[model samples]
Target: MTATTVDMEVRGPWSLATGRAFWEGFAPAALPAARGDDLTTVLLVEADWSRAEASVAQDGGTAAITVDGDGDLDAAAAQVARFLALDVDATFWPAVGERDPVIAEVQAGLPGLRPCGFHSPYEAAAWAVLSQRIRIPQAATLRSQLTDRHGDRGAFPAPAVLRGLELDLPGRKAEYLRAVADAALDGLLDGLALRSVPPEEAIRLVQQVKGIGPFAAELVVVRGANAPDAVPHHERRLDDEITARYGDGATVDSVSAAWRPFRTWAAVHLRAAREGRLHEFG
Candidate 1:
């Protein structure tokens, strides 16, 4: 197929480096190809999928993600936007920082870093199972194997396409992915399904699946749904990181109040800071 290219402006604060790092942070093989400031990925926007190459560069206060692809140019551009988290409302940063002093310090260093996430909540849920209880590298290998064997076109399998397939991961992980794929195909785990209730209740709904747990459900909410206020607190409520800052780990939900409407974004940056370093997964 002939390749087509398009360009879209990524408004607000953004950095190509942090975007690429977030993409490759969890697993490189599952994400796009990042060379310097350029990124390339096969994306699924709605029904159409495209193998798109993009160059993210500064444009005054904004950035431009120029996309070249063999599939629908418009769809590819939207996918690129979703993958890089370009459409998020970052105007809440100022209010968030003012609400809490500690977040202000962390936000100072981690500008232009959005969630940097998966294509959709369904994709996030599938990945959560594949990577469950395993290191990222292992998850990448498993994801690659599944994609190569079953994906119609692109680096990751589509919901309907993956529903009929299976993987060799431990226990019911593979089956769980297929189940969620079915749910995705049925739109049972879409944004509305998750957002219909509060984040915590949504976690319970997600845990209805065979393999998903509290941590994985939280992941689905943040990464899959790109939920602004949601934090993966199931895995981290009293870690030294929050206690050191807020002086009360028990009040994590209250502590996160300061980062209201952007906790997912803050959580990612805060975790990276807590690690003491940001290693490029690329």
Candidate 2:
């Protein structure tokens, strides 16, 4: 495959955040080759835009990502650029006002958050299903294991690769992988539709897989599929953060009120706090 260079700038507050962390979490092997002081490699997972690597460059203002061996690099780049520019409104951000000061502080700390534009809904849904009832680190580890077991050896596994594998998920995770793998093999998983479907329908389809419930489905839709309205319902840490900030009565609705238009921003803030990005509330 000939490598194509697609140069484009991502717009929106969420784009910056996505550029910073999503790739690190989702695709760890696709390291960008460092070129000069300012240009570094950005890896793009095949057919997915939710994550990309940030290879630093000497120039500073622009970062270059190289998508090699992937088909239609230009087209993929264009799609990514489009996703970054997507506009999300207040309705998408859950109502967080009247909840507690801690929630407000977390929200205020991180101002940039947005949905990751993932092209494959089935893959995202599968991840969500596997992640259910587990800690983030645990879930991430499980995903890494799955990739090693069933995904391709490159940046990310190709759907063809996922479709061909017989996954061995040890313990409870085994059951979940079986269901997701079955769906992928059966042609019931619609990669295109996931990128275009209504949020409700997307959630419904994703939940059909065993081990996937409302919360898991929503995470895939919101974080993976870029559904603007998706909010995590089962994250205890988020709840704890909210409670510590606002007390025991803090609901997702009340805590999310202040970030009307940018609820994703609040989510981003929470994630940053977890990663120790901001030392103290500003």
Candidate 3:
């Protein structure tokens, strides 16, 4: 396939090099070529349901993307931007550190780090289903099995494909996966729609799906839609981190006010730091 290539301007302080560390460690859905400085992956463009082999590398303020597929190139580029958080204008992210010392330390530790997310809300929902009640390693193995059996290349299966399959997964996960696919096809899982509203509203809406609950809904909205400012209210680890970093009286509501509109970034940073410093290790 002839590749359709484009160069996208990434706003604010960003680095594929620094962000690669997190991607390499992110286990829900392993990123392609995450071991390298550049990012290479097979993306399932939700706009037209076309599969593309995409490679992205950073040069200064721009992300150069080369895509080989028969889908909408514009949509592909936009999806790539969302996936890598290039669409977010994080120029003032550094300023968030000035207010909070912990944030400052985390920023200093993981400079130029942007939270990379699932390719789309559809995939995130699918992962939420797969991961429930299972260890990450087991879930990852199941995801790999599903991909090998049904996905195009390494991309997760399209909605129609996933919906049609009678998967042999544990519990009622297969039923839940179909429900997720149904939501995706019905536009309930569109990234734009999910990200357009308040994070709370998005979570509420996503929970309407059969298998999605508060935790899964938050996963879809905050990480799946890649809402830059969304807070993970249900994350126990974040709560623990807050108590450990701040005082025992510290709470997410009290401390996160300092985080402001970049709350998601702060939350991800805290989690990464708590999870053994992916930035430094990788």
Number of the top TM-score candidate:
3
Cα RMSDs, all models:
3.4, 6.0, 2.0
Model 1 CA lDDT for position 35: 57
Residue-level lDDT of model 2, residues 32-114, one tens digit each, is 33323332333334344223433221122233444444455654554444334233433333345334345356545544334
What is residue 73's positional error in candidate 1, in angstroms? 4.4
Candidate 1 pairs with clashing backbones = 121-224
For candidate 1, lDDT tens digit of each residue in 1-282?
Answer: 444444445555677676666566655344544556555566554435334555566555565656665667666565556656676657666677787777788777766677767766677788888887777778878877776787646546777777776466797887898888777777667654675577777777777766787888887777776666676776553255677666754455767766777777777767656654535331
> TM per model?
0.81, 0.65, 0.95
lDDT of 3 by residue, 1-282 (tens): 667778888888898877776776788865655455688878899898889888889989998988888888778878888877888999889889999999999988888889886889999999999999998888889988998899998888999999999888899999999999999999999998987899889999999999999989988888888888888888987899899999889888889888888999999888878876433311
Q: Lowest lDDT 10-mer window, candidate 2?
A: 54-63
Reference-based lDDT, each prediction: 0.66, 0.50, 0.86
